[model samples]
Target: MDRRQFLELSGAAGGTLLLGSSAAAEATPAVATTNHPKPVGAVTYYTEIRVPPPEKAAVLAKMDELIALMQGKAGYLSLSFKQTIGESTMGRAYPNPKKAILAEALATLDGTLSSPKVPYFYVMFLRFDNYDNLLASGVQAWFKANIVPSLFAYNAATTPPTKTSIALDFHEGVYTTVAAADRVNGYMTAEEISTYLASKQSDEVAGQYVSVNNHYMIMDVNREAHYNLLRENLNGNTRSIFRPIPGDAGYDDSDPDYVANGQPAAADNTFFRKAVTREILQNAFPEGEKRNYLMHGVWETIMDHENSHLDPRFSAGASQVGSYFIAHPVEPFYITLKQDRFIKSA
Candidate 1:
């Protein structure tokens, strides 16, 4: 129940719910237009990748042989390879291993999805419907003809890409949850506690990306095994928030009060329940296709990083908060990520 209560139930942005006009799609109040022509919006992207700890076993055997030689290509969605824990090849069963979650869940609009940010190294997300299908989906020729020469052929290379952001899914919802243990015994993984309950009931009760419903957990992980339930869920701020809303662009997250009198700016010290999800097996198994989705909610996401400082304007503007969020892209942040101060949990 964080991330601004999951974006206040997932809706409250400046625009999107599809209606561009027509007197505000019938005087736009919220929704209930009907008469067909609206189902087209769900292009969310997040990115980051480093991989160069000695080419982590040839980039993990050429990305598992290019995801098993393009298994079920055709608008592939969900793909992750975040690095930092020494660019893993799947050792330590991916625990405390820095970061890595290569997703792949597509709904097809025909190719082209590269650059969710491409910072340190890996960042891919291709959701087309505009920008000329992001340029006739060869998706920059499958990232320069197949994921950039298998990502620098071994010794970890590729790093010459930059993208601001390209969001356009006026709205899209998905929330089916279940949780328990919360008095802070620490443990979240029902798809990272249903993505923190859709990042806070998104738009509260209904709005933006709305679909799928089921939730119940009541209690499970806290019995005082020594206390660490996420440092009392970041002590007091209860659900933390600093300033991050607009399109949620490429977040590698860092600065959630960078461990005591430090970080501040764009902090995200791994908290959405503890990010962890890897399985781009070409949409895993959408139950024989046809837009079904939900195969164990595909690799839950959560990565408890831990870092809290409980206000002080959080380390006094922690290192320019990621260049002031890449230079304040016109500042909109609809639901106001809890009145941004760059979130705190200390």
Candidate 2:
């Protein structure tokens, strides 16, 4: 069933079973409590690396080696590598390829940084227990001592060490779980919600959601009042909680379909469903013309890429939406919604 249908059925059931007057009264908090202790949140480090066309392979190999080395470090949670495919990387992939339809959609959405020149080959995410653990992990030192030298060694003969190029950008933040869902509905009691919220402050529950193909929303918000509001208005089936990991963090590196001998895994893209509300969609793409941008630009682009690698039917609509992204990479942004403000604005 589609996500909307499932939400409808589940929500109705939840209303009947859990939305009694007493429960409803208790659900909304009068004032945000400050007594609950804060949990140890995760620290996430993101690196956007650009490699010259000729040096891509060598750089990737060094990256693999570095990742392997990090596996042994204390407090290391997970690491992921995603190749950036948009305007920045397009020219390198196809010297002269046709512009993509999705490219037009992206252009319509935002003009800022519309034509990025840096050809980023990969974006890496590394997660650790906390900021202190991240500092003690020695990842930054290792990267500087080992990986940085190889990245610039391409011009060792002609260029001075300082003149050699090493193009990368770094950002760091803490993970805050905004939403968590399980298949079961109408099972959470008010007491359960309170306990869960309190426990989540210090618990590593993000991985649990990943294992069940449940949605986990991570953000940077630290206000206790914000979370209390979410707890107050949470749909019976949907529990909004913060995690200490990046929103895009994956649980494990093993292939999701390893058990099925490489067949298209049913669990490949099941964790987060597409947003059903106009407000949520608009938050991601504010432009009127780009209302359906996620469906076309993100979802369809991903499906096309997966199908190309897995299905490969010759007659299929082989639209290279993924290729279009090489020249027009999607910029990552955060969306924060306040329930009271949203309702008033609506």
Candidate 3:
């Protein structure tokens, strides 16, 4: 099923299931402890799931069931699930030419949306007040029993005998919120971002068109220094907001002249709506033991995101931190499917 259908189903299935209270524990913007590598605050279990297009609906149904099961749990704070839009723009060109060529080609095809060769991607976020509470929830156990088997179940009904199961692939990690910002509360406290997001779902669902820019990177600098740099330098709207010229004939994203310096022309783009930064505390996937960070931004539109990359101010600020990157960042865009908070907004 498409995102809309899946969302409608999710709404009907779990809308009233909001459970848990803010008193259990609130994830505040983290403060790094000297002895522990992970920040101190709320913990999040983040997962990326890849499934064949035909199996998307079944998996999502399982997700809704899981959400229902987690309701009223002792420490549960919030849950959000989103689907990729099948569009990815590189923050910088890929180092591997083959991968870059392949990625570029796939973006133009429905393969990213669904295909045996390329599966659809989905992201899930489950937040809790603390590690102990998260462990008590038994969400992992529930997922293993209820959802894991379906991924590996063979479609014996298909024509080819050798074609067995099209099992889904997944990567999971435990993370902490480090820094965040939004238009509603400027430089937000951790609680503020959480509260803002509780109401964010309605706006996204209404528009049916929100752009989430995901920046995945491996950092070489001190984690705290990096986090502070991002919070202080990139948190504001400087050069992020679009300004129009007189008689510019309005914004046209499709115009051939709409690009400047490999990004959307300055005059045609607008600012992002909200942004946050997070760091994996455990179970780093793909690459292990390397410090990994995620910078997430919710944009008004895709063009708003593209335009920000070339802003001279952005370029200058980014250059200071560029050498700290061990690998080129992989940036992709996604749309929210379901977002529900059980905790009271702060």
Candidate 4:
């Protein structure tokens, strides 16, 4: 759909409305292309859902049900659900309150306020085998029949057992993965950062993991020349690189073997078809300082629908590096990007 149509569908007027029969008639979208020499095949559906504070639990339950229904579906790979943590400091991270789904839902419930936070609460990432299946009519039909009813059901009766008004905000888009990188520990050191930038000039790396603070850096020289321009400045920045423990193995002071080989698995380097959406959450420290003491595992799932069509040389594993710094006190916000890649299976 075009930008205008997408805005309306995600707006207050259309937020709570079901996809209905019309969605089943939507023509499948064309596969997106990238500047890369080879074509990629995976597709993703990234959705953002907003619910009132009181309805958070209920909405999540409904969402879980929807996810369960999607299990074992043709071309379906994996689905992840993440919630935004901490209060929003910026004024309306989702602006245009009049056009927001949550705002309109609240107004309908008679629970509207002058300045509601409009919880940009949940983010769902659904991966599929290809763009065609991602937009298939069967999928749309299933949502209309099962998912929509549970989410938008509102009760008008209130005599003995009053039913609360159902309010929700939803926005979604299809995306193809283009490029990704992962760092084992936290952020890269000042020296490592310099090496990374310099290597990109002579390498074909689609993307590179900088630090937990910077996360994955998309390597587009024309679009992101700042990486090269600010190389000198990056060298002086002293943010500690935060690395979580690898697995269930607890940290030990005297275990020499544990100290020698306790790092997590290295991530695979992969590229995608297009860059759909880039979400950067700076600080979602839900666990506070204690979170730092726990081990954190970071991995990427890179898949291509038409894996046979691509060259095998591009599927090589990633290189390793040593830990650079200690974990920062403030939990680092995650950087999530929606992109597509070609893989052998879902």
Candidate-wise lDDT, in order? 0.23, 0.29, 0.48, 0.30
Per-model clash counts, in order, read 50, 14, 0, 14
Tell me each candidate's TM-score. 0.22, 0.36, 0.66, 0.37
Candidate 3 has a TM-score of: 0.66
Write the residue-wise lDDT of candidate 1 on 64-120 in tens digits.
554443333333322223221111111112333333331111112121223322212
Tens-digit per-residue lDDT, 1-346, candidate 4: 2323322432324322111112223322223345222223554565444544334555566656756655546665555554433211111223322111221122233323322334334445566655566665255555445433333323323233222445343444454433222222212343332222222111111342111212111223222232232322222111111111233234443644334322222222122121111112111111111111111112111111111012132111111100211221111122232212222243
Give stretches of model 2 more than 4 Å off.
Answer: 1-39, 87-100, 103-118, 149-346
Global CA lDDT of candidate 1, please? Answer: 0.23
RMSD, one per candidate, in order: 20.9, 19.5, 11.1, 17.1
Which 10-residue span in candidate 2 carries the lowest summed lDDT?
337-346
* lDDT at residue 244 of model 2 (Cα atoms): 13
Better of 1 and 3 by lDDT: 3
Candidate rank order under TM-score: 3, 4, 2, 1
- List, residue by residue over 1-346, the lDDT tens digit for candidate 3: 2323222322223221111111113212222345445434566776665555545677788878777776767767778777765333436543322121222222343532223444556677787766667667887666556645544323434543122444443445566655454442443466654443333323454455444434334433355566666666555432233323223345345543332112233333332222222222322222222455556565555555555554456667767656565544545566777766556434
